[model samples]
Target chain A: MRFGSIIKVALRALLRNTMRSILTALGIIIGVGAVIAMVSIGNGAKAQVEAQVASLGQNVITVFSGSMSSGGMRGGWGSAPTLTIEDAEAIEREVTGIVGVSPEVRDRNQVLANGLNWNTSVNGESPDYPDIRSWKIASGAMFSDQDVRSVAKVCVIGKTVADQLFANGDPVGQTLRIRNIPFKILGVLDSKGFNLFGQDQDDAVLVPYTSHMKRLSRRTNISSILIQAASADVIDKVQKDITEVLTQRRKGREPDFTVRNQVELAQTATATTQTMTLLLAAIASVSLLVGGIGIMNIMLVSVTERTREIGIRLAIGAHGSDVLMQFLIEATILSSLGGVIGILLGIGSSQLVSHLNGWPVLVSTASVVIAFVFSAAVGMFFGFYPARKAAQLDPIDALRYE
Target chain B: MPPVVKIEEIHKIYESGEVPVHAVRGVTLEIERGDFVALMGASGSGKSTLMNLLGCLDRPTRGRYLLDGIDVSQLDRNALADIRNQKLGFVFQGFNLLARTTALENVELPMLYGARKFTTKQIRERAMHCLDIVGLSQRFDHFPSQLSGGQQQRVAIARALVNEPQVLLADEPTGNLDTRTSAEVMGVFQKLNDEGITIVMVTHELDIAHFCKRNLILRDGVLVRDESVSNRSFAATELEKLSSAEAAAKLTGAKS
Candidate 1:
């Protein structure tokens, strides 16, 4: 017999019980729908995190003071001021794949300017600090290395500081008081809304490290060092070289610095979302499995319910294979039809979520195709047993069944 | 020409419980073309079993059976199914029409399972023609539930003829119908037999057996009698008599 006619016969049988067919397909529909929605949301979260990581900097590496251990006393990363100016200079001189280096020192203090006072963080950094951090100066140029050498009392304010202290006037070349000492503002940095840590990045001031250590805070050791590699491919090499140099410089003492690259931080940031996406997808697959079982259950019931019908077909020349194909095709049709509907449901819900909450959702073509094929295969896998049962029935016995 | 069905001492034994029950034992039979035969027996007498074997619905445990010049006794299940599809047709006592299906589609069912491929238009045309032959053309679009008992039997007969099989087997075809409807259905079979279609039917009713040209009686898993009828009954005359008798009965009851 032609395959088309066989399909036609299966479809007619399914149509005879429309409500049962639809209910049987519902399992797959919900399964695929959940998988699509969950995966979309998870992907959106991962993508958002990756975008944030990119904003931190390109090909950048940071060295924070490791948990310091001296005579059994310890502190967490960044708690100890262990980095010195000589270490920064040594890295810049010895590292071959680096583009820039900036020694960093930070403190939070109440500052007064334009007859108003606000408390904010004050960071002391080198001339290459803005370049290494991928931050741009909006109005005035960054302080020169000559300024750092002379320990010039010059600084630049962030957008938040500029708004607070220099709100009524151009902040460039304005004088701001820090720790009861006056420093000239060189420029206003461009606005960077926030970092991944949810901290307001623009709520701070920048000054030469020499001026910060010698004039403002009056501390010797630095808190951290930011280094920029020439390219992404050279970051690992540069980090290794810096660690070696630091370890060698501090021989006979425990290593007091921790090295991290931009890529590693991004991976750390995205790992949670990745795990979440996989976990949600795995749970959704359970529903798909349930859907497949539903198909199998309905198919078994249909076979038993239609034993007499099967007998009639067999008596009138239908091959056992023909009967088997009819039932198998019925199941496949149910699942594949469910698959298509589930895909639509998934896309619709994800789009709705993206619209209502403004979350970035991506439903790639690959996911859609995979879900469809998987549902179809589920139908086939679960359908085999019942079809075989129907095919193996004795025609005479089936005919005589009440 | 070879006989349509030639059975050589076919035996069917069921090993369901401890003691094996021989349903049909050494039942040898031959049916020629264009002949209408009724197989008669009481319950458990093996007539139904023999009919099943003849219809290819079951295989004999020991026998060499030939159908339309093909040795089908040794054929596998699939091969037997193919033979049935191409060369045999069946009508069950329940009228076994697929529920919720139109008469036209029911008639088209056998052709769909047959090895011969047909275009959609051709399948429809053939199904319509069979319904026309059975005088159910007007009710072609009606479901089995929408049809009367006799009308449904006629539709079943139409379905049996759709694939143009070599033999049409009916197992107690009129078991579910009233006397008048049974006569009406017998009329359709008589007409088809007159057109040279071979028919084998199982029935215990003496009157129903009289409608066929020959009768075979089974007793205790064996064929006890096989003979051509000397005085056959015509369904046309029987139906006329039944309606007239009903008319007279209605006339006599009016006074009461």
Candidate 2:
């Protein structure tokens, strides 16, 4: 007999129970669908994390002041004056792989401009702040070292503050009042969207460290220090070197600063999404296994129901192997058909999620192919025992079955 | 030509229960080409067992059997399947047509498993021809559920003949039909027999057995009588007589 006819025969038998066949394949449908949808969403989340990391800065590290203790009462991080501007200069001078360093102090204040008032964060930074944080000046110029030395009241406005303070007008040469201290806007920084913490990054103002300490907050303590490593490969090494230098400068007491690398932070963010994706895929695979079991159960029932028919075929001339192949082909067709439908369902669901949540979702061809092949293998694996049972039936006994 | 079926001292024992039951004991029979023979007995007389053995569906426990010059008593399952496909045809009492299938596809089923390669077109043509031979040319597309009992049996006969086997084995072919339909089915068999196709049938009805050329009676797991029919009955004449009787009965009803 030709192989084509065998397949034709198997297809005809399955068509006899169309509704049951579809219901049987539904298990695999949901399984593969869930698998594809979950994996795509997971991948989209990971990609989003990567983009956020890149936008934050490349090959960068931040050192924050440690928690403080006074009279056995501990305070939270940044509660005391632990890091200073001199520490930033010392790290820049001591570390070999350090490409840039900036001491930052932050305070929230109300700014008055064009007869409008808006509350925004004020940042005190040095000339290397732009290089360390990958900020670009959209217009005019940045504060020079001379401005920091003279504590000149010159500032750079971010995109959000610029839009609010000047609207369509140019704000580079305009003057704004911060805490009743008048400062000239030297430039506008380009827009960078949101950070990993979901905070708007382009909603602050920048000024020379000396001017922010003397004119605005009137404080000497720095909030944090930003460092730029020359390359991503050397970020951890640079962090270690800075930590070692800080500990030595503290005279063998506990270090008053904690150094963090961007690479480690990115990895932490990526690990979360990766875990979620793996967990979803694993759960979906369990349903797929259940679907396979469904196929097996239905196949066993079909074999028993068609016992006499099988006997008749065997008596007429069909070999045992022929009977086995017929059932096997039926199962494979069911699963592959289910797989195709599940793939379409998965893609549709992924699109729906992307639309509803404004999330990025990618359905790769490799994942589709893998899900399809895996379903096929599941069909074959589960269909074997029943087919063998049918093939091994004694014709006399089967024919004599009432 | 050599005998189509030669059986020598074949014994089939069933070890299913605690005590063994011998279904067929020392049954030896030979059926030549073009022979129309009927094996008859009451229930549990081993006639069905003998028929199963003749069809090569079961192996004999004691004796050797040859079918169409091939010793198939000890052959494996696949080898026996090949022999059954190439040389034997079977018709069951239930008509055994696959449900939800058209007559044409039902007739084409046997050829699907034939060792000889045949194109789909050829298989269709040959199936149509066989259905026409059984006088069902117009009902090719009707499913078994739509067909009457006699039409279903004719479709079964067409399926059996499509493979062009050397011998056709039928078990109670007319057990489910009315008298007129039984005669009609017997008429088909008689015509096929006249064309030199060997036939071996099993029937409990002596009247049904009378239509064949010879009768072999089994009793108590042994063949008790093997004799040629002294006065054979022709199914065509019987069918004519039945229709005439029906016509007379209808006339009487009209007069009343």
Candidate 3:
């Protein structure tokens, strides 16, 4: 018997029950849709995390001064300034993997410019601060080393600060006052959107460390130390070296600073994202399994309903294998059709979700193909026993079926 | 030439449930080419079981059956299916036409499984030819549900003949039809038999059996008699008489 004729017969049988066929395929459609949607959403979230991690300089590390206990009250890690400019210089000169270092002193202050005043944090650092944080100057020039040594009253402002003070106009070479002390704006830093903590990175003002200690806060000790590793591979080594040098400088006393590497932070974030993606995928795949079971149940019912039809074909000279192939093909067509429909629904709905919720969603082509092929395989796997049951029926008995 | 169908000492025992039932016992018969034979029996006489065995739908428990000089009693299921496709065709009491299919496609079904390597065009042409033979040429596109009882039997007959098998087996082909429609269906069978196609028909009605050339009477799973019809009835004449009688009855009803 020609296989083509068998396929035609099977298709005719399926078309006879169009509503039943579509309903039978609905299970597979939902199964594939869930998998695609969940995986895409997960992938988009991972990408978002990756972009956030990239915004924090890839090779940078931060060392915050340890907290202090006084009068039964303990301050947070950055509340007390145990780190000093000498420690920053020592780590830069002694650490083998250290590429650059900058001592930082931060104080929140209200600034006056353009006949308007805004509250923002003012940061004091050395000339190498831009290199240490991988920050770029968007306009004018950065404060040179001579400015830090001569205690010149000059400042480099972030994009947010520049926007707050000057609005549409360029703030470079303009003068602003902090605590009634006039300062020259040397440059505007490039925008860095938002950090992982949801704080705007371009919301600070930068000034020379000497000027901050002498005129702004009157502090001799530094608030924190920013360090950059020579390469991504040497971050851990640089962190350990900084910790050891600080401990020894304190004469074997408890460490006075907490050193954290950007590489480790990024790795931790990646691990959490991967675990979340896996969890969502696992939950979604359960629906696919239920769908496969639905196919099996419907196929079994179809076999029972068409017993007489099978008998007639058998009496007319159809082989057992032909009957088996017919039902198998019917099941496969149902699933593959469902798979195609599901893929379209999944992609469109994911895009809709992204637009509505403003959440990132990535629908990869590989995932679509895999979901489709997997549904087809599910059809075949679940379709087998029922098809075999149909093929094994006795023609004489089947013909007698009411 | 060897008989078209020769069954020797055939016995069929069915293990249905707790008890084994013997459906056919020691039945021997020979049907020659172009012979029109009717099998007559009451219910439980095993006539249908014997027909199933002859059609190769079931195997005999003890028998040596030869169809066209080939021993088919011991053949496996697949081989039996092939033999049935190549050598025999069947018509059922229900008129067993696939419900949603057009008459032409129903007729083409047997040829799809036959041994002949016919192209699609050849299959279609041959199906049309068989439908034409059964006088359903104009109703080729009609589904079984759209057709009358007599027309559906004719379509079934066309499907049985499309494979050009040596013997056509029919079990109670007119069981579901009225007397007039039964005569109409019998006319189709008589015409096919006249064209040299061998036929085996099973019917409980002696009036229907009178149209065949010979008759075999079965009782309690045994052949009690096998005899040639002394006075055979012509199906075309019977159909004419039935239609005119129906017309007269209708005319009288209209006058009343």
Flag regions of model 3 displaced more than 4 Å.
Answer: A1-3, A62-101, A110-119, A126-141, A162-170, A213-260, B114-117, B243-256
TM-score (0 to 1) for chain A, all models?
0.91, 0.91, 0.90
The C-alpha RMSD in Å for every predicted model, in order, reads 3.1, 3.5, 3.7
Report the C-alpha lDDT of model 2 over B1-256, residue by residue, as the tens digit.
Answer: 7788898999999998999999999988899999999999999999898888888899999998989888999999999888888898888899988888899998998898858888889999999999999999999999999999999999999999998999999999999988888888888899999999999999988888999999999998899999999998899888777767877888433322
Write one digit per residue (lDDT tens) for candidate 1, span A1-402. 568877887888788889999999999999999999889888988998998887777889999987766789877898777889999999999989998999999999888888988899999999998888888999998999999999998888899999987778898977889988898988999998789999999999888999999998899989899999999988899999999999989986988889989998898889989999999999999999999999999999999999999988887878888888888988999999999999999999999999999889989788899999999999999999999999999988888988
Identify the runs in model 2 with alpha carbons over 4 angstroms from their true place.
A64-100, A110-119, A127-146, A159-172, A217-223, A230-258, B251-256
* DockQ score for candidate 2: 0.64
Clashing pairs in 3: none
When 1 and 3 are scored with lDDT, the better candidate is: 1
Residue A242 miss distance in model 3 (angstroms): 6.8
Note the DockQ of each predicted structure.
0.69, 0.64, 0.61
For candidate 2, the TM-score of chain A alone relative to the native chain A: 0.91
Model 3 per-residue lDDT at B123: 91
Top candidate (TM-score): 1
| TM-scores of chain B, in order | 0.97, 0.96, 0.95
lDDT ranking from best to worst? 1, 2, 3
- Report the poorest 10 consecutive residues by lDDT, candidate 2 chain A: A1-10
**Predicted structure 1: lDDT:** 0.90
Of all native A–B interface contacts, model 2 reproduces a fraction of: 0.73
